[model samples]
Target: MSLFRLDASILPGTSSSAELADLVEAEWTAAHPGAPVTRRHLGTNPLPSDAWPLAHTGNLTPEPERTPAQREAMALAGTLVAELEAAEAVLLAVPLYNFGVSQHFKAWVDLIIAGAPVGSPVLKDKPTILTTVRGGGYAPGTPREGWDHSTPYLRRILADVWQGDLVIVERELTLAGVSPAMAHLKDLADDLHAKALDAAREAGRQLAAK
Candidate 1:
């Protein structure tokens, strides 16, 4: 059994989401000492923005009449789907950018959908962990309540759409220590960060157990 990890943090090395994912991955590696990990870092090497549209259209075109670009895109989509299909478990680290999902991640998702059959549960029963980091607090009573537009969409795609057995490790106020405007909430941010770390480990243990 193998683990497939996708990182969507543009910041990569300094990404809070990736830091949480590393914890989860470490646990998984500990549980399965010799298992191989398949990784795709969309941040460092993003997918072409237009690939999704080409892929979507490629699926509609006849194999014999498809253009070279269309055929190539279709093939790329197939490869993406193949990775998900081959993995026993999956981990994704994504950050909230501009209160929404990153454009790179969006392209990846669209390509996957284009490759798979309509409404199909590609990850049905697969244990999946999604680590999502937010720069600001957006809890129910917070000033930015309902301003978060990333988590819900993530849940919909990972759990509802792909049918993965999803576990989420979320941390907010990630910028409290770095943003002068959020300095007053630094302590709160630290607490949230600690909680997120604990959650990551637990999620990893569960993934390994499964």
Candidate 2:
């Protein structure tokens, strides 16, 4: 089966979100023994910041009368949507940026939505795993509780908008050992990271089996 993987970690080698996604991909590879993987690294090759507006305008304009800029934007959006449409399963690795959604990921989503026909879901009923890593704790009762805005937004898009069967594997407190202010939560951070990896592996296996 084909798998589409999207990575949105700004930091290449040091990103927990990417690492966790690797674990899931590894598991899937082990199960399929050579399945094709389509990778899109938004961190390094982010969609143009203006692509969204152009896509929106293109979607509104009739195809025969579209401007050159609008045509290019629509073409790019079609390519992005094609990647999703061609895959049997999808994995999105998103790292929390400033306690909010990654602008790159959001831009990608906007393009996909604009590229699709009105009222149609590009990823309808597809199996999707959203792997996320947060630098700080945002659990209930924590100082930064409710601070996570990315996860919910992602869920709304993947599960609600695209109608995907979504599963989330999250690891928080990732900055415990790296950031001086979070030093006290190092042990918990490690534990949470371990759990997220384990969950990712399981999710991959299950998706591959399906």
Candidate 3:
């Protein structure tokens, strides 16, 4: 089985989202034993900011009439979609940025849709997992409750738009030990982080079985 994994954390080693994703990958590797994985690190190698618009134009333009730039943009989008099409499962490690979805992740999604053929369900019913991390607490009763805009938007895109069988694993309070203002919640953060990793591993195993 093949897995396509996308990482959207700028800080690779220090990113909680990346850490949780690693746990899932580890479990998947153990279960599949040498399964091929396609990795896309959008945080480090972000798609062009204007890629979505260019791809949209490319889709409207015929292949022979398309400009070189538009062709390149559309080609990139096709490559991204092809990876998803080839995978049995997909994992996205997304970090909450500026109280919203990462721009890189958003652009990637836009390009995928633009590149896909009309009415084609490229990702329909695919087993997909979204592992997300937030620097602050956003649970009910917390001061920052309702501030988590990223997760909901991602859910809409992955589940509603792509029709993926989506599973979400979330970790919050990631800045508890690092940010002085949140130091008091360090223990809680650690517990939450551990739980998220455990859940990710379990999800990975379940996905492998499927």
Ranked by TM-score, top first: 1, 2, 3
Estimate, for each residue in 1-210, the C-alpha lDDT of model 3 and write its tens digit: 989999999998688898888888888888899889999999899999988898899889888999888988999999999999999999999999989988888899889988898756777999998899999989999988999999999998889878999999999998888899888999999899889988998888877777
lDDT of every predicted structure (CA atoms): 0.94, 0.90, 0.90
Candidate 1 Cα errors over 4 Å, as ranges: none
Q: Is candidate 1 or candidate 3 better by lDDT?
A: 1
RMSD (CA, angstroms), candidate 3: 1.2
For model 3, the stretches where C-alpha displacement exceeds 4 angstroms are none
Candidate 3 local accuracy as lDDT?
0.90
State the weakest 10-residue window (summed lDDT) of model 2: 114-123
TM-scores of the models, in the order given: 0.99, 0.97, 0.95
Specify the highest-TM-score model's number. 1
C-alpha-based local distance difference test score of model 1? 0.94
Clashing pairs in 3: none
Q: What's each prediction's clash count?
A: 0, 0, 0
> Residue by residue across 1-210, what tens digits does model 2's lDDT show?
899999999998898998888988888888877879999999999999999899899888888989899999989999999999999999999999999998898999989988888757777989898899888889999888999999989998899888998999999988898899889889988889889888989988877777
Model 1: per-residue Cα lDDT over 106-144, one tens digit each: 999999999899887999989999999999999999989
